[model samples]
Target: MKPSDLDPVVDALEAELRPYRDSHHTYRRLPSGGRDRREILDEMRELASREEAKWRAGYSSGAVYHGSADHIEFLNEVYAVNSQSNPLHPELWPSAVKYEAEVVAMTATMLGGGEEGVPTVCGTVTSGGTESILLAMRTYRDRARAERGVAEPEIVVPVSAHAAFDKAAHYFGMRLVPVPVGADWRADVAAAEDAVTKQTVALVASAPGFPHGVIDPVEELSELARRKGIGCHVDGCLGGFVLPWAERLGYPVPPFDFRLPGVTSMSADTHKFGYAAKGSSVVLYRSSELRRYQYYKTATWMGGLYYSPTFAGSRPGAISAEAWAAMLAFGEEGYTIATKALLETAAVIRAGIERIPELRVLGDPLWVIAFASEEIDVYAVMDQMSARGWNLNGLQHPPAAHICVTLRHAQPGVAQRFVADLEASVADVRHMPGSQGVMAPIYGMTGAVKTRGTVEELLARYGDLQFKA
Candidate 1:
């Protein structure tokens, strides 16, 4: 659609969502006087109540991974105790240091590190998966510069890899060579090998890609990088916490961690499968020597001395505390049992998708199930599903939707409800004969715009609505 046509659509969306922005309260700045504590808490509770039902009822995908009442209460107490703690001030709060160190160490061992045969993996706790990836990419860029004397560094990445890699490339002033995946959505070994030039500093693979939920050819990709004497990072942000337990549960999970001789670094989200609260992730390296490049230390600065392991200078120790508590709260057995239930639930959902004649799953995925429709517009199906209160993930390139099965979906009758709703959605969408669904124009604007700046303008305008009172 042209700008004139898009204005109405954007306007309607903005108007409809405006209530969410300024429903009960609108504060551009602090009030003249402090409000009553009881009134503030009640109003905050009222606002939060409007958005809690859908996620709590398992109508969403991947946002709230673990949403049990007991778990939330426990984590809340943990947060309350150490709310003021900061890892930057380790001298003041030594407990934060202990928690951060143990979180990293425990996560390292989880990903086939610190074993007898495996090299000792060492890493620091990052804010989230994006930070971990950025840290790893920067580490590789610096190492290649210092050791190999390569001025212009580059990273060979599969097209299916996370966008964080692209962001890392952009932020670190490196080139990202995108290699297309094969039919099964695994990275082509030959293509990856061919992409590796002298300037290639590192190669990346995803363990169970976010789009298709299929693990890349990490074993081969890492080996290829090894032969080239370059770093190979496994972006396991989505699957690291689940794959180990899946393998232990007798499911076939490929080797995509430090156990592989060529694998140099990995990033895993504690918030996702570790059942920890948000803002916690682990970035692992094969050894401390390699991780040394990721650190930033300055003694000649005017602010006395400064050192930081990750991007942020002063990190929230409370998040690290939550990660530690979650990990200890759920040990190997806990994960194994949860994975068994989660995978079984996913099996049911996957079978349901297979049974629908109009839809075909992209690949054989264990938990994160993505599917497309040849007969109907998949985005229209997404719109219909959204009408039914399903918050699924929509993707381009192939144009599909996926539901990342979580513990919330393992709740009573949630899987059955999803299947029934999905089948109904397909039936509803199958009758539409010709034109694209209501959302076609929006996606068309994304793909059809000649200049990327036009889309950015629309996005910036839309973002402006998010704060309107």
Candidate 2:
């Protein structure tokens, strides 16, 4: 069947799931005029149990990190201890300030902040990686407007940078100049240099971009931005915690942090490889002066003085506390051990994928391994793996799938199972002639479509189904 034919099937499946979408924990008034907490708790627990398996067994990619029972319990305890704390009212919860400050400091140090005379790098705790990236972009935008009088600002970014950069550009009203990546999947520094103009506010480089897991040439790109008198934002959300330890473990890591003189700001997610609980990340600036541009303050408000360091006000202090606890609990030694396991597991997976006859690994990656096949449909293989109870990330432009090795994948027999299953999947695809799985057809249509508007409309319909309940 054609790819568009499967759209009806997908729409039907979405409609089927609509009834259960928002009915997971519906609150109804009781005859006794009180809610039933026990029933609600049971429903919530059931939902969690039903959804935990794929990620729990390490079949998924980079979603849940450090799923150990002890680690989760420790983080839960920390969060429970500070459940009532709010950073907005620092006087009420002084501990929030301490945790927030320490989290930023520890994250900065890990990302090569205080190595040299870097002037005690400062930052604020953000909600997540998107906020961190958004705040950095907004800071550059405002700083350029104030200092350089750049009204119509433009941000030079590699095509492989995170989608959040595009979100930042839209939110801050800045023009985004996307520089194409080279054959190696790294950003083209010369292309970025050519894209920059007087209205250019900042340049962006990613340390191991999300799609292909290739790091941009930060040293060259940042220097280009610096010479052009524009800001450079290094997106280390993926590699910030892992790469530092990977470098110390003697991996070939490029210079992609504040260590580069031209790197003015960076976004790193503590929730990711840092092993913190979700909803926590840090955005660091080269100096407090640059950070001030990211802050919001108003004295003319009807309510007294109001200020927010990052995007959100009255943020979840519990998540911040959990992030701090995770970092402190897993100090440098702990991170080093985790990083070693992750890198070693990634190496094993990479080698196994390379051994497969039909498949080729994309670029040279540490943990995130993207592989494509020349003999069989890669999406068909992905569907086969999915049927076998595995969840992997699908990539386009080259039609590949990736398995982001996390601690779960490092478990005994997990890597071997992945390789064995992948081999079986490829064999199945080779033998099954003219076969296209559900996603294969979809991806095929996506590739062949000339108008993106139709695809976007389909996406919007999918979103509507998600909220149909």
TM-score of each: 0.96, 0.94
lDDT tens per residue, model 1, 374-418: 788887788789888998988767778899999999998999999
User: Cα lDDT of model 2 overall?
Assistant: 0.86
State the displacement of the C-alpha of residue 378, model 2, in Å, after optimal TM-score superposition.
1.3
For each candidate, the alpha-carbon lDDT, in order, equals 0.89, 0.86
The lDDT leader among the candidates is 1
Best by TM-score: 1
Q: How high is the lDDT of residue 434 in model 2?
A: 54
Candidate 1 residue-wise lDDT at 415? 98
Question: Model 2: per-residue lDDT, tens digit, 276-388?
Answer: 99999999999999999999999999999999898778888999999989988989899999999998988999999999999999888888889987788898898889878
